[model samples]
Target: MICFNIIQLFVILKLCSGMRYIDLKSNFISDGVEVQHGYFMTSGKYKMFHARDPALEVIQFGETRVFPDVDYTPGTHSLFVEQFKVGDEEALSIYVFRMSVTSNSVVYKVYFHMSEFGYKLIDCAKFTELIKGKIHVSLDLSKSKSHPFFNIHTKEEHGQSTTLIEIRKSIAGFRLRNVEAKRYEFGRIMDSSFPIYMGYSKLNMFLTKATSIFIHKEDNRKYIVLRHWTKNIRFDLMTVNGILAWNAITDPEPSLLEDMHQKVFRLRDRIDGYRALNPLSTLDLAENISPELLGIEKVTGRHGGSTYALYHLEIGKEAYNKIKFVVNSEMLDMLIAKIDDRTLYAKVEVITNSQRTFLIITCLMKIDLVYETVINYYDKPNMENTSYYHVPEPYQTKIVSDMYKKYPVLINMDIDNPPSIVDHGELQYDSYILKYFRIKQEDGRGSVLSGKYAFGDIWQKDLHEIGNIPYEGNKRRLKVIAHSVNSSRIIVKPKNMEYPLLPEELQDYVIIDG
Candidate 1:
């Protein structure tokens, strides 16, 4: 490919009382190779111009003309101006003349040489003749213009020197000496039976673009119409108060929720809602307990065998102040107790203003619990973990370092690994490891410890083993052991651990069975 950094070109148009100008800069790179030789038209009117190096002095003018009736032979022509000094006068001449075509098949001859003028007219007819059987001619008038300074300024004579007008034109002058014939063939036409326009509003101006659609036929007499366009389609239906603006399509708004609701109702006519009846008698007891008493108004219950239940508590607004103080104290206690772990993952949240405080609890299996903690920002928050026991700045580093020491296996995964839920025995976690390495840092007390560890693993061995495990072993196969630490916190630990019997050291290992 040939890269060309084109300088700016300006065209000034003058009207009766106003003037307008157009500025343009073009960049192009040509492969110097052709696929299906043809003629192409420029988007706007333009003329080709040539200039000498250094001073960019213009010396000649010409235009390119194509004769499509000629054979479709594709190639490139590179020509540059050669200049010289003519005894007290600056004389310009052609420097290089080269034409490259397919297969190294080229012919040439010198037609005329003006030795006194320091120029020669090379015969391009022989070269054109060779490709006459397979040439496609295209016209290019981009080079037909007077030089930049031509006729614009008065010429001044400086003792015994004569000025010459520089000409700028297309090099199609070669066409006058050589001729080739070619033809054109049209391609397949595009289908037009589809939505033609899409509209969007920004501030006040309405922007639109051409769109396409597809139609599909269904069973007996039904049909489906699909609109294919950019996903970011938004329209402002109305704007009021300069604060609330409703933006949506006027037609029926598409919604996955509505479709899911309809599907659920169609499955069973007697079902009122999608919730299963709570079998544990504590369902009503959960609602009676005040959020202040429980620390949080939420608790998880289990059928004690397999199934689990989540309880949510609601209180009136009158109890807000009392519950707020009590909940805060409980939260502080939970936070302090969690400080011993290398990394603390918990949620201490309270929704205020309502008369009644509400608490929500969700029951999670071991794998679900661990996976959520490692990947979920809400659980393993990025908040600064500082305390009066240590300097605030290095608290996060200390916690992360301690976490690695306690769970060294988790740090071995490369940082570049693809995003996914990975299960190793009782522990399930999501890791994004692309690169692997380790770093060490010291605390304010001067205790050196390894900090950051990143790595990537492409093998998906655990996924395959889990998929093939028998039902009998899988039933008793616990992935994790989860425990509720308090009203707002839960902790999960992997129960299975095993060492591979391989001779070489195991690069990465996951607990598969307890």
Candidate 2:
């Protein structure tokens, strides 16, 4: 009976190893740096502290102040930490420390408060002293809508920097990815490592250890995949779920993959069938759609622009979802010029027939590739104008009917004439309209198409303004601007990197009084 109790006690101790700590004072040392008056816990408690770095003696002169309870529940894996006040001034004078713990590491995101006292001490070197390393800051002030963001990097390895905290508009978000302690040439000790590779869906998650499973989210769709990589070899394949049990297999069976893929196809069929039975006006469907259904198998080739990369995925026979990834290289160059590390603009799009497209995301891909935050193109109205007009003759009607046969019809206008929708002056037509364009490329100063085109043999080549009535002093000017057959989204590489793709009000004239 004593031995049995002892065994049970040992099991309890093992289970209770992960304990929570708060309000504990410890002038403890970690990685050879002194941490004072902060919380402490067991070996694997993922230590998070909320005390003023006593080493920050320059600004520590004030009345002793306590902080709110650190509301962190280990079971739920919550990411909530309170701030500690230093000065007896306003709330802005307090130091907000948001610490995040993953499977392998603990990250401290220290923000020098937004108060008058805190704002004055925004010095890069001084802030580093408050922490425990020689840190570098990257300030991105490119977007006018959003304020500058500071990326604090730990300069640990000789001539190498690893990001620790990202301070955006006063909130500090910590990321501990591949951090290793080392001494720099100037005797400054800090954390450094290779740039972390975080996928689209993984933005909501933080992993300290190298992850074999990754979740990718695009266009309101979520997909799970298994990926493994070494110095020279890499393997990536889609999976149903991010289950560790399935990942434990040394090698997945071909039959297992085939069965899983067939099941995914069946799921897509069920979703398509449901949509057909109950059609909706909004593109945001009611049914939950998995990204695994419309998965991007591979990247085909490069599009016209230097920054744009094209990827292909098979939706169905004769139907495709051509995806385009736009990376602003010019802006990246400017960022490189300004700071050692620059923020990159990475956007993804899904293009189908007849300008039926979706803007998946317009986000900032960090230079380290550790994080990506979606850019909300401020609250603007859905500026889209759609109209329907009938074709006069059998020839034109036949041409329109062929395109209509390829896709579902929408009788929105209540007109005998099938309507054509125009977004920002660009005419949207079906895949059958592909015969109306001719693909070409630029040769010298005057060029036809920067990319591929498809033209009908019946029409004569002429320059014409496609959109609306322009205000010409006394005359109307008809000029060919650009054309794309495969992609509905316009691709324009601006010489000035600061130019934004703001929505322009269409100068369209629609006759309502028929």
Candidate 3:
């Protein structure tokens, strides 16, 4: 309780005085990397210790401490007091400096300091001066070759850069590039769905190809505003120009910084809200969340729309075992959902927000190896045995010819014959279609017979017709090659086969070869 009181007192004092300093005992991590305790020189005294981390383009400090005898006065330090730290863990503080590549050289200045409730910008002397007899890292300016230059004004004849100055700028450029590359690398490793363009710019008039940074002064304090745009979202960070300070997102916005700030804060709040829920398990987390919480809405269809979220959930013990989920608003009118236990189960809905269909769902099971199988209920059988398409008369013969070519036993008897046109008794042509038929024998084997009498027609028809009609000559039978036992359906070959007449029967049967 005493420690808490002391901390509270310190915070009140710091706020009242507006003196920024770091508390060195707090936990500190920077850019996903842990930072060690360190000190900065102030007024020729190494009295301040700090923990620093790199965030975006600047280094933010926390856990700051000051030695005894240092006057803890607010608004007293010079803007260019060499350097200092304003890190406080419990204060949610951030303080930093920034570097930018100008046309002639790299410029350095104190950036901004920010806390949970407020932010401040410092205005100080900007410098490009190099330390004497020192060498710095070289900038690979070639990386910006593919980048275009825009609205750049360079004094070609006024002066040439000294080799020392060029070297210094190159070193600064390398540092900036390293930071950018590290950021991209982190994004790639995490497979971040949102593209992060750190210092991204199409035009590279400067070595850094930095996006435009705007400076504004309000209430005698200067602010440096930085802008970045992904395809779907925009972001901006505002910091003090000369002091190690920055305004919180809650700070009063200048009109130019309004929209992007709103968007970013909205998203940040959403994420923070979910994290605050602190589910004990994955299922609990999934069950507790809704689409709206992630900025997703009931979309019309499955086409193009902005995605609200994309994230992965771990389901197994393996280091790489995880499932990805993506939520998006679609342009389509139907709401569609598919579920695979391994990762997702999406529900699709119609434009009216009505349930349309439940797609197939697969469940992933872990055994010796992870495997997936469709649930039985979701796997419906194809309950159809009818022709899939109607063939045109002209194409029917060609189709039969192709089928016969593939299977020689499948004879094309009417390959060249077209049905003769009836001049009389057009209604009699319909009589040939039997209304119903049934097999008399219990062991109904091959095809059924449809002829009137095999007894009388045995001598009139050729041997092929008689042989084709099984059980011929005595009781006489005509094979019903294809029968609709439930309904009287007839299938007369190559001719009728092309456009087969429906069987007039009452039973359902499909011929299958043994």
The per-candidate count of clashes, in order, stands at 45, 10, 49
**Candidate 2 lDDT over residue span 293-372, tens digit each:** 22332221212221121222322311322222222121211111111123233223332233332223334445465755
TM-score of each: 0.16, 0.19, 0.19
Task: Write candidate 3's Cα lDDT for 1-514 as tens digits.
Answer: 3455655666566545544333333422122221111121211111111222221121223323322123433322211112223334111112222422322232343323334543344332211111111111111212221111112222323333111111111232434223221111000010011211112111111111123333343444433333322111122223321112233332323433334344444433443444422211111112122322222222111111111111222112223222222211111111112234453222221111122211221233443464433221111122332111223456555643542343211111110221111011111124343222122221121212222101100011132222121111112223323211122121222224232333444234222111
Report every candidate's CA lDDT: 0.22, 0.25, 0.24
* Model 1 regions lying over 4 Å from their true place: 1-72, 75-406, 411-514
Candidate whose lDDT is highest: 2
lDDT of 1 by residue, 1-514 (tens): 8543322111111122121111111111111211111111211111222322211111221111111112322222222222222233221222223343332121321222224443334344532332223111211112232222122122334322222221222233322122421111111111112111111111111111112212222232212222213322232323221212223342222331233223323322322221332111112222221232222233222211211222222323222211211111112121211111222212222111222222221221135245322211012222333211212334545534533553211212211232111222221233211222222332112223232222212222132112222111111222222131111111122233233332233233321222
Error of 3 at 65 (Å): 72
What value does the lDDT take at residue 49 in candidate 3?
19
TM-score of 2: 0.19
